[model samples]
Target chain A: MNPIRWLVGRFPTLALARRNLSRATLRSALAVTAVVIGVVAIGAIGMGGEAFKQDQLEAYEGFGGTATVEPASYIEEGNLTNTELSDGDVDRIRQAAGSATVLSVHEPTDALVQTQSGTLLFRAQINGLANPGEFYETRNGTIPDNWRQTVVIGSRIADQNDLEPGDRLRVNVSDEFDRNFEIAAVLRPQGFSAPLGADRTVFVPTSQFESGGYEQVIVRVDTRTGSIDGASQAIEQEFNAREQVVRVEQVQEQREQFTEFFSTVNQFLIGVGAISLLVAAVTIANTMLMSAIERESEIGVLRAYGYPKRAVVSLLVAESTILGVVGAVVGAPIAVGIGMAVNQLLLGDPLAFTAVGIQYVGLGVAFGVVTALVAGLYPAWKAANKRPVEALD
Target chain B: MAPAPGDDGVTADVTGGTVPTDEIIRGTDVVKEYETGGQTVRALKGVDFGIAPADFVAVVGPSGSGKSTLLNLLGLLDVATSGDVRLRGEDVSTFTDREQTRKRKETIGFVFQSFYLIPTLTALENVEMPRMLDRTPTQTRERATQLLERVGLGDRLDHYPDELSGGQKQRVAIARSLINDPDILLADEPTGNLDRDTGDRILELFDELRTDENVAVVTVTHDDYVAEAADRVVTLIDGRVRETEDRRANFEEGPDT
Candidate 1:
């Protein structure tokens, strides 16, 4: 068949798709716009969930390979054993593991650092002080083991006391003991990394930590598989067999809580996204139905020309699918931008690049297409089945 | 013109002698009934008919005479209760509406008193509709334009149906009917809505279509003058034939028979 002739034979019926939409252009545009809105909502929510998952992974990366070993004391004084892991212990783990970087840590007992501004307590929360080889996370000043009368402050502590390095500090070790001390290393903000070691901490020497001394070691293990786990398990076994008052735990419950909270938020966002899509679908259906009613006679002419009912059905479907695809294509990039903007305002960070994969975008396009078809089906069927005699009369 | 005493003049023994027995349309023992509001009313009673291919005939009757019921049956628009209707030799009683419509498109064309030209279409498009329905676009378009040219609406082809006068609309209608080159033209009072001059022109057009194409033409008219224009006239009253007359029904059988 001469395709143009066949198309012309269809007359206004062929033209009906465009004219049908044009007649109620506002309604049709609104319908497609609804699909766009739905796509944006769904894409943002889906992308946000994936971002949260990444943040959880970043939290794990901050730990590197350190095993925070706990002391063997509890319940009574609400304090675990600070059975200081001496320099020998650090050397032994380094020698035994060979593939690990080990650092021993301790927290001082009673001490108050009084400056020219005011007095702030340098109360160490046990096994948190380092002996000045260089802590991976010092907010300001290094902990000095060479000069025993010096200490380092954490980011939280520095921010809290409005203090900086090169400051003179008065340290009263207890009510009975006092000395003048210098400020050592100040630590940077470690974000969620400090849930393992110390988020709000001050570091001092092993000599300064008199009674309940250091028991833990932060082992930065360069492991591929379960080497951190293996190392921690090995240390626990060694202590258990030797009747030592110490054990190692692979602390991660805090990270798990963070993940669970984010996942719940993600599920809630998805629910809202789905509801928006459903509303968009209804708008599409309504648009098509109105168009069908407008072009009744045009469809009648096609029927009279022996164009067959299915062709009329196909024509309507094709037009709707085009509408859907156009809306989705246009909506996607706009939605991504808006998603980023929303993240910046609500999540308090200019959002990082989150790729809504091509497949996800393709699925969004497919969703738009399917929603349109679903919207167009009944209208197309009614158009196809209309009696030519009735329409002509 | 009076027959000898007791010689009824209608349906004289000429049926076996002069009239050809082979007919293009035959309706036998036909009865059509319609039920309305719990009442069964018979529209036709055991009707019988035969039409020849060359005849230009008009079936004339007053209102409520079952003339329409018989015409509908003959046109294959309605079904008979318990009878056979043959169109061009096949039993049309078994045909579905779609098949009947197809047969009508190929074999029969209709003209209505109301001049039912689709108001939205131009004269050219209206003329083209049936052909578009029946044939390829090239053929249908060529035939439609040719028919319009034939009917003298060649200049006004692009004018909408509403733009045409009654006579011009009828001319376009006539062109449309012949688009598929149908074998029979069924006109129900083709000139009923026109004035004398326009009606005469329409009748003249019908005569041209019939005489030139050799198409069998059946028209239904109430005008005695219109009846006289046909080659033969069949009068109906109370759902029964009252008179069957040729234009020269007064003549006796000559040697030409």
Candidate 2:
């Protein structure tokens, strides 16, 4: 025999419930539709939120091993002094960060750029790294190994000024020194949280800075060979062993903040979804109450024939549960399909569904069943507690 | 211990004789009351009744005579306010709710005037319902089939209640009542909705069940033909047993016997 048939034969209450629900096809269908809507709302929203969060987290993928070490401001002789990191500090950071590349970045300076639009004066962030090729990708031109007397502009600056590689431009640094140099390259636009604020910045050789102290030390660790946490801890210990001298900010911390933010958003969305399920629960309660009222005499007949109160309750609850199961079974796959579409829309990968997303579907289905069961409880109890004599009369 | 007929404190003996030892069910001094609209109304006032095995008893009474109330009490569907209702020599009040349900399922079957067949279930499934409560479907399937065939519903076993006529529905109910092989079948106005021909056929089926299946049949009805067909008729008036007419002696000596 088929498994469902065997199950129905084994549990006659289930069989009766199935038959009873089928008796009012339209009512049962409407009830099931309500549950389906609830399940779809919960599951699809949960899954879509998860996919969005994952996509956001993926944007921070390559920056996980990056950390920025900046000198913390200290009071010196009754005056607040924001000191620059010395060469010794850079050496210590490099030593502490095992198998990591350390680069010193100069403080931003107000500069006048000769663009086709005009001579625009803006605060331009400057990097004084020896090798820019290791940290940045160029969109228009390449950075030479022996890069000297040349400047690399960020994509934002290039786009704003219509500047290109090999273009000759004069930049006045801090209104003190000026030089005309060929633009070596236009760097690609890094995302919002990129170290050194790569966008809206310019790259120059360390020889151009003339200062011995560095404004910021950028450390990039190869996660395969070294741990970012270990590097951050070592850097912090080396600089602030006795007092607060340098502040270490790991990319992981920002990622953690983003994750927390997304988690909160996911919960809120799921809560919104649960409200729909609550409405579905009320619908189920109303449907079950109506069915109990309609079947009062039949229930009395069952009671008179020796069905216990629990049996009557069980029969009614079974009907509701069947509605739940049917709705959830139908809704889960549709929600999954919706999730896939959301993933495709947001993440550009239809198969980017995470295990957590699938778990949300399961959670939605479980909630749907639980909601139906709870909704049916009162009606079942009321029906079961009815006096057979009163019902028959 | 059985209470003496008239000597019992509650009510005089309406059976006009001593309680039989082989009685399947007995009620002594049964009083049932209900609070309706802030006033207490006694549905059955200290009434004594009994049913022996294979007995065909009809309870005939006018409206407000507590015929259905007595049937409800006898079927274990309701409890008496003050009385001793015994089944198979055991006091019914001593049984817990679950035990009462078990006893009712195993020993007594109930039929209703409305037939009360589950509209969703087929004739065979309806017959199998009581046995299904015992959770032995494989064992009772053949019995349900046999009972439906015996009730002349063999061809209509798969037909739902809505598809069956009044007489056919009543026959299905009669078959369902016998599915558990109950010693007593309590029916409240079993033929109240049927025509004269259908009612007569149902009464005949009751007679055949009592004689051939050895099941006692107790029906509460206002139909005189039903009262005439019974081996005994108990008349109730204003919540009290008015008379008990014994026709079993005449029935056994009749031409059919």
Residues B101-213 of candidate 1 have per-residue lDDT tens digits of 56766776767566667665679878776654343677777788898988788899899888998889888888887876766777778777778887777677666765667
Per-residue alpha-carbon lDDT of candidate 1 for residues A203-230, written as tens digits (9 for 90 to 100): 5555664543355666667656447777
Work out candidate 1's RMSD over C-alphas. 10.1
Per-residue lDDT of B4-116 in model 2, one digit per residue for the tens? 12112212233454555667777777889999999999888877776776777788889898888888888888888987788877988888888888888888888888888
Q: What CA RMSD would candidate 2 show?
A: 7.3
Candidate topping TM-score: 2
Tens digits of per-residue lDDT, candidate 2, A1-393, equal 577756767888988998899889999999999999989999999999898787767656867798889999888899878768888888888998878999887764455656534565364566666677778789989898888889888888888777899886676667345777788999877654567667777787777766677888888888888888899999888878998889998888888987898889889989999898899899999999999999999998888778999999999999999999998999999999999999998788988999999999999999999999999999999999998889999
Model 2 chain A: which ten-residue window has the lowest total lDDT? A115-124
Residue A156 C-alpha lDDT in model 2: 83
Q: Which ten residues in a row have the lowest lDDT in candidate 1 chain A?
A: A123-132
Kept native contacts, as fractions per model, are 0.06, 0.67
What C-alpha lDDT, on a 0 to 100 scale, does residue B233 get in candidate 2? 83
* TM-score for each predicted model, relative to the true structure: 0.57, 0.78
